[model samples]
Target: MKLLASGVFALATLMASSALAQAQAPANYGPAIPGVCVYYGAQTLAQSTVGQSVSTRMNALSQEVAGELAPYAQSIETEITALQQGRASIPPAELQSRSQAVEQRIREAQQLEQTRQNELRYTLDVQRRAIATAVDPIIVAVYQERGCGLLLDRESVYLMNPAMDITPTVIERLNVALPSLSFNRLQVPVDQQQAQ
Candidate 1:
């Protein structure tokens, strides 16, 4: 009688456990499958008109700036070569002074280069903002059309199915809507004066 009772208890516990597992299934499963959209900013930017134009202008500007500093760099280099080649008898004190002067000139050139590059970066930021501004509407439209709630960066994604990516359409629409960065991309979506 005790053995039969033990078997019955065991069967009851197993049945209860199975029932609990089934009841908890809804918590682990989602109501609808979530899909993701990915965008590659660098690739899209490279293909955009604003990006190309910005790159071209910056390259030209860099060349011009390099030209301005090239002569001083050559002078320093030539002095070093001359010192090495024994073209002149350099006294220890004189050599130290000359070396310091050359180093100073190189530092000045480096500072100028960095400053100009920073200025170029500012220019690029402005251009990028313009491009992003222009692309927003198209991105919104595409998002709406595709029923996507979220947009993701392509770079950070570790592992995702290729079917989830949405960069191509975004790139196409961006190119269509924004041929250049000269245009202001935003307009009044809602009347703000009325709110005041």
Candidate 2:
């Protein structure tokens, strides 16, 4: 659960840094013109209604996974506490076996935690791709509508007129095109899970 929280924070931090970079762009790039435009893909995705829905859904899923694993965690903690309290009275051989069992349980819990994290990550990636898919044509349409010949990622630009940013237009069209997305946790295949 701590790992999941940290992962979410890391994602937020990355998005914030991206936005800051765009904000710090030099402001003297002359007046806006046709045939050239910038799009802040990260910011657009983060700010859009559908994107917020995805984020809310992901947090719910993370909480669900934590709840599902709570018993394993509790059981492990109980066993460890019992072992420590009775250590003086336990025979050496029995103590070794019990300790090994506890270790095995810990390892199993760790593996489960890792699997859950991987599933969450995979689910997020898939959803982000879906959102991107929905946003692509909208962006293209906006580009053509705005008569843009060069479409640059905001991340790649160090200077641009604020008016030249088509991100809001793209996001608006995306909200109309895809107001929300419904998805479930992606159950990664065994082979892929092991690879991760």
Candidate 3:
């Protein structure tokens, strides 16, 4: 009798929990409407005219920095070669000093490289923000026009209908709204870069 009573209690508890779960579950709204839409923000940025322009400018800046650093790199390489070639003739103490100096120069070169990278990153971030600022209104306008209730970043979505994606439309509007951006490499202070 006790076994039967316990079985009954367990069944009742399971039924109650199932009922609660059903009550808490959200309503399934089948078929996506304009009310729910997704967009690929990164793709829109990459394909947009202003984004391409920024990319080109960033590439140019990177190439320019590389060119500036090339001479220093070549000089370091030559020094290393000379050290290796003259290793036997040089006094032990002098060799140690020369090696230490070369190491210092290498460290300085690495620091300079890191600084240039930070500057490039800062410049790119500024340009991307500028582009976002310009496109924000256009995105808002489209959202309003489409009567969107929920805007989802495509990246967050696992599986979505192709029709729900508004990326191309957003890109089209972005191209019309912002054709190009004029900017230069941002020079970040050494202190600011180091703080990060």
Candidate 4:
């Protein structure tokens, strides 16, 4: 009789455990609705008028930096070559002083390059932000007009229909709404800015 009672108790426990497991299971919410519109952000930005202007500014800045730093860069190269080739002939004191000067110039050049890069980055960011601010409303209007429930980045999506791509239209509208954005370099005081 005790054995039969134990068996019945085990069966009841199993049944309760099964019921608890089922209760704890998450409810099915079904599949998500797919985004209807895809936008190639990089392509759109590249094709936009503001983007082209930003590119032009960036290129100009690069050229200016190269022009300014070319002499220093050449000096460093010459110093390195001289040290390697003339180490035996150069007196110890002169060699030490020249080495120190070369090192200082290298550090200065590196710092200047970093500063220029930071300024360029800052300008680009400001320009892109302006473009985004101008384009966001247009994107929403296009999405709504097309009856798209959602918009997704084309870069992230693995597969999509060409018909659903809205990049061209977005870029077209962006150019009209924002033909150009003036990028102003932020003047952070050298003292306040971190030592590059």
Q: Pick the winner on TM-score between candidates 3 and 4.
A: 3
Candidate numbers, best TM-score first, in rank order:
2, 3, 4, 1
lDDT tens readout by residue for model 4, 13-125: 74575467556645653344455888776666666897777766666665666787889899899998999799999999999999999999999999887776667666666
The whole-model C-alpha lDDT of candidate 3 against the native structure comes to 0.77
CA deviation > 4 Å runs, candidate 3? 1-31, 189-191
Looking at model 3, which ten-residue stretch has the lowest summed lDDT?
A: 1-10
- Candidate 4 lDDT for residue 81: 94
Ranking by lDDT: 2, 3, 4, 1
Output the lDDT of residue 89, model 3. 99
Give the per-residue lDDT of model 1 (tens digit) for 1-196.
2222343465466457546754654433323325556666765676566566655555565566567778877887998887676636778788788888878888987876655555545555677787888778877787677777777886676445545567678787777777665422122223532332
Which predicted model would earn the best lDDT?
A: 2
What RMSD does each model have against the real structure?
21.5, 2.5, 17.2, 20.5
Please, what is the TM-score per model?
Answer: 0.61, 0.87, 0.78, 0.72
Clashes of each: 0, 0, 0, 0
CA lDDT for candidate 2: 0.86
Q: After TM-score superposition, what is the CA distance of residue 146 in candidate 2 from its true location, in Å?
A: 1.2
Model 1 stretches astray by more than 4 angstroms: 1-35, 86-88, 91-93, 158-164, 181-196
